[model samples]
Structure formats: C-alpha cells, structure tokens
Target chain A: MAEVRLVDVEKRYGGFLALPKQSLTIEEGEFLVLLGPSGCGKTTTMRMIAGLEEITSGDILIGGERVNDKPPKDRDIAMVFQNYGLYPHMTVQQNIAYPLKLRGVDRKAREARVRETAEKVELGALLHRRPSELSGGQRQRVALARAIVRTPKIFLMDEPLSNLDAKLRVSMRAELKHLHHELGVTTVYVTHDQMEAMTLASRVAVMREGRIVQLDTPKKIYSEPADLFVAGFIGSPSMNLVEGHITGGRFEAPGVSIPVAAAERGDVVLGIRPEDLELTTAEAPPIRGKLYALELTGEATLVTLREGATSICARGPAEFEAEIDAACALAPRPGARIHLFDKTTGQRIAA
Target chain B: MRDRSLQYVLLVPAFVIVLATTFYPLAYSLTTAFRDWDLTRSRRPEGWVGFDNFAHAFTESHFLNSLWVTTIFVVTSVALTLVIAMSLALLLRRKGRMHTFTRVVLILPFAMSPALIGVSYRFMFNPEFGVLSNGLAAIFPWLEGTAWLADPELAMAILVLTDVWHWAPYMTFMCLGGLASIPRETEEAARIDGASNIRIFFGIILPQMKGVLLVTAILKTIFALKMFDQVVTLTGGGPGTSTETLAYFIFNVGFEWYDMGYASALAWILTAIMMTISIWYVRMLLSERKMATA
Candidate 1:
C-alpha cells in the first residue's frame, strides 16, 4: 500500500552507535525482510520504520512523505512485536478493535470489521478468549488480526514468529506469507532466522555489525552472497570455506586443489555451499579427500570430509554411504557458483 | 503404614507447640471473657457474668465512638495509600539516573522505624516550636493563631496524613516490583495498538498489578486499623478523645481506668472485628483471582 524509504538513517545510544548511516527502499506491497544475527540492528531498523525509535540522523519517508517528526500513531503504521504482544488482559476481539477505536470508528462498524478480520485469521472462535487462554499459534493470529483490522499503509513485524515452537513457527510463517499476499500491504519484517527470510521475503537485506552487506532477491543473495560474511551466513549447515591459494589458475591447499574459473588467480579463500560439492567415483578426481563423519538427516546424509587437515561438509543423497575414514572424491562443479574471496579484505573477488 | 507413622512422628513436636502457644490462649480468653476476674481477685474465678461484660462494653458510648473513628481512618488511609503508591510506581518505572535518586529518597521514609516516625511527626506538629505550624502561619496569615494538634479537625487530619506519608512508599516499592515483572513487549504492544497512556495504564498496567495491590491493601488496612503509635505520640487521644483509635481506647480502658473486666470484653470485641475483616479480605482476594483466571 505504501513504499517505505530510509535516507541515510542512523541510530546512536550515547557514544555507542547502534546503526551507522543505513539507506534502504522497500517497494510498495513488497515483503522485504531485514535478516541478520542477534545485535545486528535489524530490530532497530524495524523500530525506526515503525516510528517507535527516533532517528539520530536523516529522514524516513513513507508514501513519499517525510515521517521523521511524526509520532507512530500519526504515521498510520502497525507493528507486530517479536513476542506477539497480544494484550493478555483483553479478549481477542478487544485487542483487534483497539486501533479502530483509536481512529474513532463507530461501534457497529468496528465490531463488524473485527468479526470479518477475526474470521480471516481463523480466530472467530477465539474472539472472546484472553491471550493467556490461547495457544501460541492462536496468539500470533490475534496479533495479525490486530494489524489487519487497521488496514495500515505499512506493517512492521519484528520476528513475530520467533517465540513459537519450531512446527508452529513454520505454520505461522506460511500463514504470515499468505496474509501479506492477501492484504498486499508493504511489510518490513526483521528476523535472525535466514530460512524465514529466504522463504517469506521478496527481497532480503543481509546485515552485519549495524551495516547492510547485501540487499537483493532471496535467490540472488543465497546463491551469490556479497562477501565472506554473507557466504557463511545465508545457508543452513553453512557453506564450506577453505583457506587456499590460487596459483597457475589452480586453487590449491594441502591435499586439495581445483581449477579456478579463470579470473580469480591469486591468493583467495575458496567458498562452496554444502550442496555444491558433487561426489563422484571417477578414478582421476579433480580433488580427493577422506570422509571424517556422516549424519543421516532424513532426506540426505551430511558428510564431513577432511582434505589434509581442513574439514568440509557435503550433502549427499540419503542412500549414499560414506563411513569415517573412507576414501572420497571432491569437485567444485563448473559454474560461477564457486565464490572466491580476498583473504585479507573479506571482499568477494570478481569472476 | 510406615510412611504415615513417620509423618505423624515428625509432626508431634509441632502439634504440641501449636496447642501450647495458640489454641490454649484462645480457649483461655474465651473462658476469661465470661468472668469478672482481675489481678485483685484470687487466682480462681469467683463468678460468671455471662454476656454482661459484652453488654457493658457495647453500651459504652466512648468505645463505640472510637470504633467508628478507627473504621474511618483505616478505610480512608488505606485507599489513599494505594492510589498514591500506584501513581508513583508508574511514574518512576522507566530507567534514568534521576529515577534512582528519587526512588532512594522516596523509600527512605518507609525504611525508618515506625516509632521514630511517630516521634518526628509529634515534634513537627507541636504548637509553639513546630516547623510545620510556623511555616504554615508564615505563608498564610489566616493560620497565625492555629495550633494543629489542639484543633480536633486538624489533629485527625494530621494523623491520617502522617499515616499515608509513612506507608505509601512501601506500597509504591512493592507495586514497582510488580510493574517491573510485567513483560515490556506487552506494554509496547498496547502502545502500538493505539491505546492512549491513560487507557493503557488503567486497562493493562492496573489489572496486571491486581495481586500485588490486593496484598498491599490488606497490609495497609491492618496497619491503619491498629493506628496507635502516632495517635498516642501526636495528641495522646487529646482534644477530648477526638482521635482515639480502637487500640488506644482499649489501652486507656485496661491500663488507665484499671477496669480489667470491661477491658477484657473490649479486647474480645476488637479481636472479633479484626478476624472478620481479615476473613473478608482473604475471601475477596480469592474471588478476584477466580474472576481473572476463569
């Protein structure tokens, strides 16, 4: 419903800078998630957008209007906190009707809208129940209902599903994505979970140490991380990183060497995702290693192999068997997916 | 069988102590309240006056008057304490260096001994040299000849005000503990829901503090009901017994008048009143819990 733009936004607590001059633009009706680990200023960014935290420098523009001086209420934005923050004292109906009441909606109209919104979130039965009496998932639905009832221009959610259990978190994630699709409101979600960001966000902004390292589509950010940090951060089981030097167009370490993609011919750290390492039975393998351990995780068996003294994780089919200390062959497939980064600068080397 | 025997064996000493210290006195008091026994009389009771003592004490206008006074003081002071304390707790909850200083200064009065507070207020309301009267008269010439503790209205007012001053801070401290325990996200959620500050306080913070407020209210009620020390020190129930509380009235009857029989009956009446109030308070609290959780 509205495009949110941050122009050189910054936050500071005394001498400690929480956020250092960050800029971003979230398109209208786009689900853009700011993703990072803890203390990475993702929540601060969300709060600033919601008008909960004051900006130390620069302005926030919502729908092409400067909102730096506006209070949260005047900005017409709704936020769902990380804890789901349902008012425990009020029934679900009251919680969802609060914003409408603040806006001076008449009683009959407010009740009708609340009923409709409650039904949308599948909370029609729970409208009379206090938050304490509801389960985790129900409370999350109430939070969503509260946000939707207002029909605000932008929705700011700060890891709202983090408090739910793993199974509930997954289901709630799907529900939230569906809700965003149905409502089509510009949403800025903050989460430390990369998988949530990857699945729910149209565009994901990866942050580290108060600065955004990469901002792009989920697939682009995951397949092509901006640097050593993003490469290590985005994937589960993490990408395999090895300290190797590029010499004579061949990347080499102790007991492991693979041909680089032509341009990265110098000392560079080699990065490959766990899924990118292909295991083959060819006699003259491009690289050879010995399996150190194997973990059977339902769908696939994760193999940890050691090339000389370095350890790398690789995902193989469930039927694949590689015992500890078994001989194995390794190769980085021919593509630009194999990332090379400068060892000193941590910057990705252009292929 | 062995477990039951072991439990009974462990309970024998505690049971004996309870019988000796608690039920024995209660039985003795019941028995003695029916008699006209005193120190002057022999150890053995001579006669049973059966309800005559109860009749005598109930008929005494002084005892009835003091009972009414105690009720007024208790209800007013306790209600005032809760209102003022909850307000102060909410005001000081957010973090700051100034908040810390204010908290320490506020809690200082509650930390002082009750007897000392009584003595200090006595000097403060003294007619000639008291800073309170001097300052009041200096600012308002209409109070030039006013001596607070001598006036019946002023004396009763001073007692109630001092009681609030000495105890409201303790309630504030407890309410602050309750406030701090409420999750910050819940409050933030309410704010984002567009509830105004007053609405949020009444609807969210106040209800969440119900348990702590109930307990503190009971305590303040008890303290005010036994309002003796300050009353005795400040005016000694003077100005023709205008400020005579139930506790002071009993003391006056037993120690000053030396009417042991009448005093014993009055003591029993006071005990009955206190027991009834405590039972009612506890019942209301239980019902409140059921209402909230149900």
Candidate 2:
C-alpha cells in the first residue's frame, strides 16, 4: 500500500479553474474521502490522483515519488468508477482478470487471484456471466473485484456504490469499509453523499468552489466546522443559520434575542444543528417562535419553527409533541455545538 | 366487411401494376431460361431446352471467366471498402469541429451519382489528358505510355478502386453512427483499466461496430456483385472479354450477342450465388447477435 499526496495540485480548463491550489495527503491504508456537493472539484481531485486527469500545477506524489507525469498504469493505482464500468463484452472472469492480464501475470496465478477476490466480493458464482447478464449489485461487485484483484498500491473509488439501489448501496458501503480494513490499502473515495463520506472515511475532505474548506475526521468536521460552507454542507437536514445582529453578547432579531458567545458580538450567522434546538413552552421566552410544521422520518421528526421572516428546522424525537402554527420557544444547544460565523467573511468566529 | 372491400379495391390496382411490372418479367425470364430462343430466331420460344442452356452457360469460357472476375471484384471491393470505411469512421469519430468537418467531407462522395463517377474516372485515366495518368507517368517513367483501361487487369483494378472510393464513404458514415452511439463511459472505463489505444480499438471499438459493419459489407457486396456501370463505361468488356463481369456478360449475351437463352441462364446463376451469400451473411449476423447478447 502507498500513501497518495497532492501538493498544491491545480486543474484549469482554459482559465476556468476546476481545482485551484488544492493540497491533501492521504496516509497509507487510510480511507480518505473527498466529500462535497456537485461541481465542488471532488471528482476532479480523485481523477487527478488516479492520473486520469492532468495536473495543471503542483506535484502529486504517490509513495513519496512524484507521479505528476506518470500514466495511470505506471502509478500503480486502480479506480472503481461510479458507473461500475465492468466491460460489457467480457464475462465476470475476464473483466476481473483484465488487469492481471495487462500486467503480464500468469494464467494460473491470475485465475487463482480472481477466484480469491471474487470470493471476497461474494461473486464466485457469477464469474462465468457477462456484465449485462448480472444484476446492478452484481455489476458493482465485479467492478470492485476488477479493481482489487491486482492488489494495486492504492484504490481510487469515484463513488463506486452510487449506481446501486439504496439498500444495496448501504450494504456495499459497509462491505467496502470492511474490505478496506481487511486489505489495508490506501483508498481515496469521492462522493457527494454526506452519509457515505461520514460512514467510510478516516478523514473527509470537505471542499467548496475548487478549494478544501476542511479536511479532518468526520466527527471533527461535523462537530466543529471550519467555515459556514463546511457547517452548512456536512450535516443532514443541514445546519440552520439565523441572520441576526450579535448585540450585547446575544443575537437580536425582530422578535428574537438568542444567546451567542461573548466573542461573537456583531452581525453573524448563528448556526445550529437540527438536533441542537430544544422545544419549550410558549410562555417561556427562550427565543419564541411559531411551530410551522413537523415532518416525521422514522428515526427523527423535523420541526420547522418560524420567528418572524426566518424559518429554523429542529429535529426532535420521531413523535414530536408540537402542533403546526403553535407558538414554541427554541433554545440553541449551549457551548461548542452552537457555531457562530461572521456574516461578511462566512468564517467561524473564535470563542 | 365494407372496410375490407375498400382495402381490396385500393390494393387491386397496385397488385395489377406489380404483376405487370415485376412478376410478369420474372416469370418470362424463367420460361426463357428453359427454352431455346435468340435474337436471330425471335419468337417466344421454339422448343424446351431445360438444362441444356444452363450447361452451355456454365461451360462457356467467356461466362466462366466473367463469373471469376465478378467474384474477385465483389470480394476485393467490399472487403477493401469495409476496411477503409471503418478506419475513416474511427479517425473522425472524435467529437470536435474538425472531426465533424471531416465526416461531412467523407460522405460527400456517397451522394455523387455512380454513373457520373464512372464517366469522370474514364476521363481521368485517359492516359493522354488524364491528370492521374500524367502525374503517375511523370513520377514513374514506366507509366508514360500506359493506358490503364487498355489492359484487362488494369481495367478491373480501376473498377474496384473507383467502386471502393465512391461507396466506402457510405460505409464510413454508417460505422460512424454506430461508433458514436456507443457510451463514452465504456471507452473511459477501458482506458482506466490500462488498455492501450490499439488494444481498445481492436478489442472494444471494432467488436462494438461489428453489427453495422456486417450490414455495410452485405449491402456493398450486393451492389459490387452487380458490377456493370463502371465496367461498361470504363472498359466496355475490354481488350478481350477479360474485364466483363457477370452482369456485363449477361447484358452482352442478351442484348449485344442476342443470345437470350444463355443470358437468362447466366442471370439465374448469379441470383443463386447472391442468395447463398446473403443467407450466409444473415446467419453470421444472427449468430453474432446471439453471442453479444449471451
């Protein structure tokens, strides 16, 4: 296994920068995920690392050697595309053995390795079938098997599980994690799915507008987002922000005076996770707001509260005890969970 | 019942026209093939000859040699057309302004009239005023006085060459459509799998184009088999009967030599060969489809 590093790598398509001055280092055997919304340069970053895309500037070093000019095969990296690009013409056996054949591996050893890898992906029975004959999930297994059979130095997965159904996607996500743990190969996975990134990566690189906003463990990124973009992008239901003035160490709106840390004493974007909001009686003046609606999603219910013009969503227990249009108080969770970002720069304020 | 009567009324005129235009001539040819009739003794027929004319047509040196020439022309021209067309398709299949321009230029020849192309090539190989012959002779002294249409081999070479030049572009356009319809992700996947461009071309691109290529080969083969216009225009059965193809030989026997009985037998032979080849081509395509879908 080899660690893959990008030192100030940049990509531009005739002055339209796809990835601008991005740098990242993935440890050997680490599952580092590049997670962002669409058009965030995450896929471009993965493609650059896999040598599928050219690096316009800076060096990409794999296993401590500059691989900027190296071809994909010479770089010893295997990529599993989101489409599960199993060769439609070749049977599962041939598709899995393609890399081995390209590398000049012997037939006897190649077949043995394919068998072993196919078993790892639970595809032994389907080897004789072509890709078109296989199911969606089976095609994904074949794609994974093709990438892993050669035991390349690094595995670059560009949302490999995205093509599978929701149920299969989750199962394959777990399987990919288990496989990565078992093989201990450095893997760089790119996905727009925040949950997939949270579940799979040792370090998730959260990117925005061609630059990385934060690159840290999933827990760290979620708990302490570096900027408004990271705070808004990482979590489900997304972090809700109140655009109010931080007057007298407390944010003030038309009908609200919510608590803010003493340091953030200006116009700021007061951020709160959906689960961070606590519902209280209307009589109590803890940022009073009318309950707009409640949406139940099995595990949790999203409670939308309106204080004047702004609407804030709060996640309560599945059976939320609140009525629509009922006046309720919202108290932001105290301490580190409450994020305050400068409205002008959108950067997190020091507390 | 009224709708059925109306449909029958509409079809009756078309049916009469079809029989008079198509079937009557076909039946007359079959009847003539079995009789002894010629322009010299022109009646419907004198008596039944049955297989006598067939045996004579097969044994005739001129007819057999023309059959060989036609086979050579069809096989060589169709094979060369597919090869050149597929290459042109691949070369211009890339998505760009220049590739689009090249594609348009390549298909322009297919729109030109075949007779016009034959007439043009006739003048181009005139050996005296022909630019091609003059250029070739200037470059190589051996071709200074060579009349390309005078020699039978050279005449047949020019025929196959002109046929390929005119029709290969049509095949190229067909194969281009086939190639363009393939998913771009497939090639990207192959490239990421570390297959070189050459490997991708043979293993991935060519195999995918097989269906369209097969259709191109069959259509070109059928057209090439009836090689007449270029032969009649360029060589006129040439120095001897050496350059006469099966179609030209049939025309010679029926219209020029006035040997209708022999020409009808020759027509039947050509039709039988064409039917066999077509059946084989279709069977091969069906098997390929089964394999791809396997």
lDDT of 2: 0.85
Q: Residue A96 in candidate 1 has what lDDT?
A: 93
Model 1: residue A263 alpha-carbon error in angstroms:
4.4
Model 2 DockQ vs. reference? 0.49
Q: Model 2, range B19-132, lDDT digits (tens) per residue?
A: 999999888888889888888878667678979999997678888899888888998999899999888888777677687678678878888877778889989998899988
Clash pairs, candidate 1, are none
* Residue A84 C-alpha lDDT in model 1: 80
lDDT, candidate 1, B137-253, per-residue tens: 889889877878888878888888889999989889999998997877777766776777888788878887887898898888878888888877777886888899999998887
C-alpha DockQ for predicted model 1: 0.55
Q: Pairs clashing in candidate 2?
A: none
TM-score of chain A of each: 0.97, 0.96
Report the C-alpha lDDT of model 2 over A1-351, residue by residue, as the tens digit.
Answer: 998889988899987878878678999999999998899999988888878789899999999999988777788888888888667778899999988887789999999999999999999998899888888888888988998988889999988888888999999999999999899999999999999999999999998888888999999999989989998888889998887777667777755677666654657788889888766654646467788888899998888888778888888778777667887777765542778888899998876
C-alpha lDDT score of every prediction, in listed order: 0.85, 0.85
